[model samples]
Every structure is written in C-alpha cells, then in structure tokens.
Target: MRLLHLSDIHGRVDLERILRAFNELKADIIVISGDSESSSLLRDLAGRTRVFYVSGNMDSISVVETARELGMLLDGEVLDVEGILLAGIGRREEHDLNRIRKEVKGDWILVSHYPPLDTKADIASSGRHVGSRIIRNAINELKPKACLCGHIHESPAIFRLNDTVVVNPGPAFMGRAAIIDTENWEADFTRI
Candidate 1:
C-alpha cells in the first residue's frame, strides 16, 4: 500500500499544494503526525481521503477535540488498514512509551510527534540528540516496521533500528513530506 506521511502542519502549510501532491501521488492513505492548528482543514481532508492523525505538543486542545469529533484521532488507538496494524501515540511521556510497546503487534506502523533519541532523524542543528529516550526504548522493544514522527524541525531524515525504519518527514508546514511504499518497504522523502 502507498502511504503519504506528513507532520508539523502548524497552520503554515499550503493546503492546496498538499492536495495537489496527494492527487498526483495516488496515495491510499494520508498520515499526519501532529502540531497543526487547523482542525477544520484536517477534518475536510479526512472527508476526502483516509487520514489518521495524532495531536502534537504544540497542538491546542481544540484541535484534538475537533479531531476526536471527526473520529480521526489515532492517539492510543490501533487501526487495521489493509492487513497492516497501525498504532499512534500523541503525548510525549514515559507512560506512553510503555503503552506503545504494548500496543504494537505484528509488522505495525507507529506514528508519534517525537522522534526516537540518538537516531539520525532526531539530531538537532546544535548536533545534539533532541528526541525522546522513552520513544527510542519503546522502538527497540517493539521493533515495528516503521515509525513516522516529527518534532525537531531541523532534523528531517530516516534511520533504521534493527528491523524498523524510522522517519521524520521534516515539517510539512515547510513543504516537506514522504511517500512510503509499504509493500516494498521503501520511502521517498521529498519537498515541494
């Protein structure tokens, strides 16, 4: 299955361009990690395409409420799409780390707002690992097929931890995204 991954919308992204890319990419589903302020836009997008999302640290409570109203919030939930188990966690806490490890099953895809610590995807401009150690530990324990996240704006890259492929598609508000062909387990990171 082809999945379009995005994160850090934060009200600055051009929704029109994102729609154009969605159409051109012919994606089966659109996954947004978080940090968006516009829940109306997210709800509208979900009406048009299959969208799964989580609230970020920067997201307001209203945004989460709107997503919950639309039944699009994936936080602490597991969704089955085309035989793939997809799980997501929004809050950045150690408790969530334990929950995520227990939530994952089989070859699943994990979505989070924080990148795992010490990975290439979490390096900051200051050359520090500014990611979640809890997330990293959970990843090491769960070993999901892929982990999609974005929190540190400057750190946008892919990393591998054993059998898992971790990716931060940069900040979508900056016109960056990723296309993942899950069947072949390949990801193409791009900027528009």
Candidate 2:
C-alpha cells in the first residue's frame, strides 16, 4: 500500500495542489496527521480516495464531525485495511498511554498528531524536545509498524525506533508531503 502522509495543514493550502500531488505520486491511501480544518478539502479528499486521519489541536468540532460522517476518522479506533491494522490516537492533549495501549493493539499503523519524544521528528524550533512522553512510552510498548505524525512544524523527518518507522511529513500548508510504501516501509518526500 502506498501511504501518502500529510500534516499541519491549518486550512491555508488549496485542494488542487494536494490532489495533483496525490495523483502524481500514485498514492493508495492518504494519512492526515493534524491541524487540517478545511471542510471542503476534507470532503474532496475523502471522496477521491482512502483517508485515515486524527483530529489536531486546531481542528474544529465540525471537522471532527465531518470525518466521523465520512467514516474517515481514525482516532481511538482501529480499522483493517487490506489486512493492515490502522489505528489512531488524536491530539497531544489526550495522550493517555494506558488508553492508547489498550485501544490500539498489535503491530499496527499509528496515526498521531505529535511525533514520539526525543526522535528527530520531535525537536522544536527552541531546540527543546516538546514531544509527548506518553507517545514515546506507547511506541516503546506497542512497537507499531510505522507511526505517522506531525504538529512540530519545524521537524520533518523519517527515523526509526527498533523496527518501527516514524515519519513526520512536514507541514502541508508549506506544500510538503511524504509517500511511504508499505511493502518496504520506505518514504519519498515531495515538496511542491
């Protein structure tokens, strides 16, 4: 499966640009990490292809409701897609290690708004690690196949924790994204 990861699009970008990227990249699934609140864009993308997303801190209730209506909300739930277990743990505010561990089981794919603590993807502009310790602890416990996340707009990177791949697709409002192929769990970033 080709997973196109996007994040931090706080409704500034256009749909045409993102669609063009998705089409050109030949993405099979679109994983949006957080801060995307444009309702039109969400509907358009969900209508076009498979989308699994978690609500970000900036996302409004309407956005979450829209995702739920479209059945594209991945927060606090697991969905089996082509035999791959896809799960989510939304924003950083609700980071519960026990709840996350209990709800999201197995070596599945995790969609979070914050990158795991201390990884290359978690560094802030201030140089201090503002990542979620709960997320870090959960990753150590769950060992997901890949953790797709965002929110630290300055840190866009792909790294690994043991066998688990961690990816932050930059910020979508900046016209950046990452295409991760599940066959190899490798990524190719595209910046428009």
Candidate 3:
C-alpha cells in the first residue's frame, strides 16, 4: 500500500494545500504523527481518505476526542489495515514500554509522535538526543518493519535499526512529508 506520513502541523489551516498534496501524492493512507490543531479539518479529510493519527504533546483532549469519533485516533492501540499490523503510540509525558511491546506483532508498523532515541531522527537543535528511550528499547525488543515518527523538526531522516526502518517526516507546516511504499518498505521524504 502507498502511505503518506505527515507530522507537526501545529495549527496551520490550509486545507486546499493539504488536499492538493494528498491528491498529488496518490496515497491510499495518510498517517499523521502529531501537533495538529486541525482536528475538524482532519475529520473532514477522513471522509475522503484513510487517516490514522496519534496526538502530540501540544494536542488537547478535545482533539483526541474528535479524532476518536472520526475513527482516526490511533493512540495506544494496534490496528490492522489490509493485513498490516500498526502499533500506535502517541506522545505522552511518560511512555509505557511494556504496553508497546505487547502491541507489537511480527513485522508490525509503529506510528509515534516521538522519535526513538539514538537514531538519526532523534537529534535536537542543541545536538542532544531528546527522543524516547522507551521507544528505542521497544524497537530493539519488538523489531517492527518500520517506525514512522516526527516532532524533531530539525531531524528529518530515514534510517535503519537492524531490519526495521525509522522515518521522521519533519514538520508538515514546513512542507515536509514522506511517502512509504509498503511493498518494498521504501520511504521517500520530500518537500510537498
């Protein structure tokens, strides 16, 4: 399946631009990783395309509720889409490694708002690794097929941990996004 991965919208409201990108990319699924203030807009987009999302630190409970009602909230759960198992873990003050490990089945996909620690995608502007250690540990333990994440806007990259590919699409408000072809596990991050 073709998937569009986006993150860190941060209250930007350009539905026409977003939809144009969506249509131009020809994606079957849109996976957002967080920091969006456009829950209502996302709810509308969910009617047009498959949208699965996890809330970021900046997201409020109301946004979470709206996404849940739209069937697009993917926090702390496992969703099966066309035979692919996706484990969703939204941004939280504290992460639960045990819970994440439990949700990971063979070759699963991980959708998170925080990038795993120590990867290229986890570097901060201060050069410190401020990502989630729990996520890194879970990845080592579970060995998922790919982990799609964001939040570290400066670190937009695609890297590998053993067989697992890690991707951060950067901040979507900055016009960064990624397209993942699940058939070959290839992720191409671009300026959209």
| Model 3 bad stretches (over 4 Å) | 93-97
* Per-prediction TM-score to the true structure, in the order listed: 0.94, 0.93, 0.93
Q: Cα lDDT for residue 78, model 3?
A: 81
Q: Write the per-residue lDDT of candidate 3 for residues 53-134, one digit (tens) a residue.
A: 9888889888888998998887877888988887778865244344566666865788889999988999999999989887
Q: Give the Cα lDDT of each candidate.
A: 0.83, 0.84, 0.84
Q: Per-residue lDDT for 167 in model 2? A: 91
The alpha-carbon deviation from the true structure for residue 11 of candidate 2, after best TM-score superposition, in angstroms, is: 0.4
Model 3: residue 28 alpha-carbon error in angstroms: 0.6
- The residue-by-residue lDDT of candidate 2 on 21-98, one tens digit each, is 888888888889988988778999888888888988899999988998999988777888877888888863354343
Weakest lDDT window of 10 consecutive positions for candidate 2: 91-100
Residue by residue across 1-192, what tens digits does model 1's lDDT show? 988899998988766777788889988988889898897788778778888888899899999888888877878778888999888878745655556666568878988888998888888999999888877877887788998999888988876788788889999988999988889777889764
Off by over 4 Å in 2: 92-107
Q: What is the lDDT of candidate 1?
A: 0.83
